[model samples]
Target: MVTHYGRAVLHATRHGFRVERPLQNPQALLRVAVGIVLGTVVGYVLDQQMLCVGAWLAGLGSMIPHQRHRLGVSAASAVLLCVVGPVVGVYVHDVTWLLYVLAFLGVFAGGMLMMFGIGLGMRAIIMTILMVALADLAPDVPTGLTVVKWLALGGALGWICQLLPPHGPRFATQRKAVAALYDALAADVRAAAEGGTAPQPWPGPLLAARQTLTVLPQFSRAAAASLFGLVGEAERIARNVRVLQTAEGAVPEIYRAQAAAVAGALSDVASAVRSGRPNAVTADWSSGALSRTRSGEAHENRVRDLVDALTEAGRLVDVPDAGKAADSWQHTELTLLHSQPGFVARGLRRLREELTWSSPVLQHALRLAVAATIAEAVGRATGDWGGLGEPGHAFWLFLTAAIVLFPTFEHTFSRGISRSTGAIVGGLIGWALTLLPDARALHYLVLIALLFLYLAFRSTGQPLMIMWITAWVSYLGAGGSSAWTRTADTVIGSAIAMALYLLWPTWQSKSLPRLLASWVRVEGQRLGALAAAWADPSTADPIALDRMGHEARAARHKFDEAATHAESEPVHHLARWTGPELRLLSRSVHEVAKCSAMLTAHLPGPRLPGVPDAARYAEPLHLVMSELATAAETGAQPDPGLTSGLRDIFGAELADTLPAWQPGPDVFGRVTHSVEELASAMHGQEAPEHRIRSARREAH
Candidate 1:
């Protein structure tokens, strides 16, 4: 019979074996391969194998996916490895006991630094641990210093290679991301015009574009601002298309041709943005379509406004002097200026906030620290027993534990399985390769080939990548005995990591309620902003609206990520909502976001009549959502009448002013229905409508 712990391990193991398709990036492959090759060649020429190893590891560390900061990360990684690794190596050679203490502190510090960001934190841990491992491998102080010189040489070469490829203009990645968003929007518009089922809300590209643009250097502020404006226009167009789709029969059959033309134009805009070319908006379909429709009709007005938006977007894309246009846009400049706090100050503030015991970063750091220390002690003890060949072999044990123990149970568990399996397989491969080559030239060729394959298939999944890494390291160390020893160390280290997680698991369920609550609060803010825009379009700040949209999208992404991880968990005692309840609530929140987007899409122009009581009606809805958020957070029941009161007020307010053809009443109704469902779910009951629908199905 399986024990409770056994069953939990089995469950997590199943999730661990899942694999993702590999991504192919030729530029990245070229950059990493060239750096490694150059480092290895220099090390061989100098007759220092460990120096080549340092170069290989440093090059690997610099292989971050973000092009914008890849150069900076590469340079930093080189410096950290060359300087810190040598210093640690030379000192630890004399004071053997000092190794364990530094191991614990380095791992803990690296984990804690993750509170700032993943990139910074991971680099710190990798550099620190690798340096200690390298120092352990050194036979003497003189050898250690020589290795440091090699490291510096290798690192410098890697940094210089990154500068070799000018991928394109400064904001190329940002442009590509924004262009992809437009492509998605165009596809959505075409689908909506065909009366197909409304596309599911996919905010990924939009969020990516926003994030990429936000990180651009201040020197390209003007160009970045233009890209930001394009991102905003893409969002607005998507929202309008969603609004048109939701209003059943809003786009009459006669106007479908015009809608198709508009979609084609959007495609052209995407192409223009991607290629950095001007797109002359030559389409007259909007004017011709307007001429055929009656003036002031709801559908006609929507088409006209959409056309005007398309025209403006085309003009923005074609602007010859983007900097001049960006200068004239005072609001975007002000937003950028306001956000320019010193980097050090911003980092410190974030660090302070994450220093608490409740922070996930701190919790993960503690777990990693404790685990690494334990691995180091156990490795040394095993070495004393002669179970491992040497004390230096403990580096494998320490390295495995450091990399495998991640923040969440799912990742840590999965990585442990992958790392173990790959290490075992890779060790066998390395041992087999040793049987074929007694010659030094043959050995170097095999090593270089293995390195190239490793970098190329790095994206395939951890198991494959780790296998290649293990093989290369085994080959570098030179012998079947060493390979076997490394494999054994890896398996033991993986077991330790798994045991630590089982004993002190950071279950995603524990954070689900907080994430869900945060999402609800963000949606409430987005609705309030939409209401304000509708009340007075002239006063609406596009930058503020864009910011709110970005926040809502980010919050939704967080909740979704937590929900996904929580599903694989063996226990849900800490979760406030059941799996089905979480799914229903997530869907309801998504609907609420879509409705808000639709309302924003139909916001009147400056000269048009405004919704007189838009804010007054929205106030109650916002308060109700806030209360629901609070209830989710506190695990308390919300007011039973909160959603009902929202519906009553919203319905009454929109009934007098909004036309029958308008989506305002429909959007409000959908929002209220979703809110009511959330309230019912919180109270541990099926929503009234959900129950009624179930009964109808049963009767049928």
Candidate 2:
């Protein structure tokens, strides 16, 4: 019932856990339980040397949904872990404890050396070694064959857990996350207009939001790995949609107005909540720019129109546009994110505290990059041998770590670090469990119970807790033995990863404000292109626009990376000044989309949407943007009248009224503010257009 953030706060307060995530639906949880039980029994039978694993772990072959079947992947890793685990375990088992320790060091060094290696090989190799050493600790000597059989069964069961169904309370969580951002931006525009009061804060929710970002990439990765095929479409849909920012061409003026309103409203909400004020600006239903006012009559038509354009822009994909009030209601995602700046915010907070690019999403990426390189190294060392007989199938783990992880490098670091931290804690717990005066079966149960506990409730970005729990289970099945070796291996692997990633580093990163400055440059260049285009609408300069798009993409990517690095590297992540800056970026780009639409739209021979030269408003808008960028970079308030003055001048001179055009929510609010803010930014600056006036003066 509680929103994700609320639950996070509750968990943090109650369990000393700040990061929290969704509760699996009863049905989904039940399915996992079923899989585990069946798997345990099957594994039991197989350990007794009974069954054939003519593996289908590749596709839906292992009972995981076809969507999730990495049959090709699992087949390879399972083969290695199963076949190689014992061979390596056998030879190493006979060594003295000192020799064993030496071997561990060799594996550790090998992991880093193979850092540039591919895939899940890293995990396969190291884990294989751990399994082998673990077998040696058993009272009875484990033939390589026994280790292989048990590992195969365990792996098959793990695969089955991943194939479970998605039966959660489907509140469209993913969709909500994205939509909230849209709504928040729209709200900001409206708030800026009408000389609105600042919004009140919402502390409770902010805590939850903070926890979400704190959870790392590993959890998401683990979920996808487990869920496989079913997860692919939904996740890809979100990702591709996000990348559509620069690709958007245009939209209707009314829709633009509405989006502007939402942007303003969201900004207000974010500011208010972060400041801890619950009495945020109340929504004014009548303030919108839709064709009609009533919900039933106008909401559907107007909302649908906006949704359609969003699709055209590649921002929104796969919406039915029924315009349910629930669908359009704001505060779902963006506010949640803004409210709990702690999780996502800490990175930015640190960045800003230290002049790094401090945006939430970007910070996460940086985290991922740092952590992944380490995890990759760890996985590689698991099965590797510097010069021993038959190294572990660690190459599989390496390939998996490299290939499956890190969409954005920064994010991977964030995720990998979170995983390592959690893994250490969980691994310790697993060790503690071994010390209990319990029988072999009891030890296995204790480990499983702890694994389930973590799976059910931990707030996480990294699911290393899950991995540790599994490793502990392996130890137990090996018969209350090998805890010391397993623990050592984990700690060593984590250390290797951290050491390599931290050592003399990529960015030597001193100043992140440069990123903000660079962001302005990128935004400026983009505006300049728009300016040239607006200067003459009839001129088809596709190349400039194309160039602008590429620049925007690169800037966006860099900003994200900068934010990530800023969050992770130094004591304080750099680039704090960048957060509020999103306003200008979002606003300018939205205008660019509008300008593109105005110039490109062919209307039976005319652009009669409003006044005569409304399309020509581009020149002034461009001027406003150039000045705004300068002011934003300098941190001083610009003349607050230029953009507004331009907007008004354009409206009065060019806008003829649209018949029956009821301005959507807060149009007056939006138009009034965007111009005001633009003007404020441009105030006192020598407008780029000033050259035109000067040239005329010389002629006079």
Estimated TM-score per prediction?
0.87, 0.46
Give stretches of model 2 more than 4 Å off: 1-17, 22-33, 48-150, 153-289, 293-432, 435-444, 457-481, 488-496, 499-502, 507-518, 532-554, 564-606, 609-700
Off by over 4 Å in 1: 1-15, 19-23, 67-69, 92-105, 112-117, 176-180, 183-201, 251-322, 330-342, 384-390, 532-546, 659-661, 684-686, 690-700
How many steric overlaps are in each model, in order? 0, 126
Residue 297 local lDDT, model 2: 34
Model 1, range 63-163, lDDT digits (tens) per residue?
64443656776777778867775677677866767877777788888898765456666777776676667666778888777777777877787777778
- Candidate 1 to truth, TM: 0.87
Which lDDT values do the candidates have, in the order given?
Answer: 0.72, 0.38
Q: Model 2 — TM-score against the truth?
A: 0.46
- Per-residue lDDT over 646-694 for candidate 2, one digit per residue giving the tens place of the 0 to 100 score: 5465345433332233232222223334445334322323333334545
